[model samples]
Target: MNIEFTLNGSVQKVTITSVERALDVLARQCGIKSLSGTCFEGQCGNCLVLFDGKPVYSCLMPAFMLRDHRIETTEYFTKTREYSLLYSELTKEGRSLCSSCHSGIMLMGMVLVRSAPTPTRDEIFRTLSNVHCDSISPDDFADAVLKTIQHLTTARKIP
Candidate 1:
């Protein structure tokens, strides 16, 4: 079947089989390079993408589900101010994530901070818990997310 969707601000049409997943279609058919995964089970968030501005595990999403939807890969997101802000806060904590997890974490952070500029620590942790990674301590990750939220709050208050 042929499906059309907006990918990284461009409309694209790709053919997909019933068994094909969005992760594969994005990379193989649509030439999206920012998504990759070790697990196709969605346990690892390495295949994360923004589906209509929300982070989703592409590995588990059927290709047909992407029809008429908007998809944003990490590469596209890297150009956004939200990505820069999240990346800066994460780096300020002095820990570096693997490339895959870094993308997932940053995307998740953007969603969290945008949806709730003043999220509680527990809420932040809960949102971040979706990405399975061991590079940073949970408490440390929470701290970084909190800092990102704080930064956004401060910026919004200015002017």
Candidate 2:
């Protein structure tokens, strides 16, 4: 089936099989390599992407569902101010993350911070838990998320 959608700010019209997964279409047709995970199931956040301004596991999303939808990957998100805030916060204090999980964490952080600029630590932890990676401890994740929220809150107060 031929489907058209907005991918990373670009409108793309591509042909895909009815059974093709959104992840496959992204990597093959749109050339998005930042999405990867050990589990192809939705359990792992490795294949997370912004579907219609919300995070969704691309691995389980069928290509048909992508039609006319706006999808944003880490590749596109890295160009935004939110990405900058989350990236700097996540990498503070010599912390590091693998490419796949890094993308997942960054995207999740953006979502969390955007939706709730002052989320509780438990909420931050809950969001972070979605991305199953050992790169950072739970406390560390919450710390960075809180810091990002602080920055955004401070920025919003400015003229």
Candidate 3:
């Protein structure tokens, strides 16, 4: 099957097997290494990607099903102002520890923050439940989300 789609704003067309996983197609075929495949099954959210502006586990999606869809990965998120702010905050105070799980956690946080700029603590926890960041604790994750929300709110305010 031949699939054509926009990857991080770049047009890409590739021939792949209909059953090929989206994660494999992106990483192996397109050189998109950021979409890590920690678990081939959907249990792990490591292969998360934005499909048509919504977060989806690429490992669970078939390549042929994305024939005309738009996919955005961590690379694209890093370029955006919102994500950059969160990234900076996460890095400050030695809080932004990078590991195999950082990409997926950050990606999921971006999606959650974009969808709910003022999410409650529970909402934040729920959003991050699927992630497995060894360097960060639950409290730390909640704090990050709260900080991101506060930062966004403050940025939107006119002094």
Against the true structure, candidate 3 reaches a TM-score of: 0.87
TM-score for all predictions? Answer: 0.88, 0.90, 0.87
| Candidates sorted by lDDT, best first | 2, 1, 3
lDDT of 2: 0.85
Local accuracy of candidate 1 as per-residue lDDT tens digits, 1-159: 999999989999888999999999998988777678778887888899989997789999989999999988777767776678777767774678777687778777777767744778788787788789888767877777777777777887999
Please, what are the lDDT tens digits per residue for candidate 2 over residues 41-68?
A: 8887999999999888998888899999
* Candidate 3 C-alpha lDDT tens digits along 46-119: 88888998778899898887788899888887877778777776677877666677887888778777875477
Which residue pairs does candidate 3 place in steric collision?
A: none
Model 3 root-mean-square deviation: 1.9
User: What's the distance in Å from true for residue 16, model 2?
Assistant: 0.7
Q: TM-score-based ranking, best first?
A: 2, 1, 3
Worst 10 residues of 3 by lDDT: 90-99
Candidate 1: residue 110 Cα off by (Å): 1.2
- For TM-score, the strongest prediction is 2
Q: Where in model 3 is the C-alpha error above 4 Å?
A: none
Report the alpha-carbon TM-score of model 1 versus the true structure: 0.88
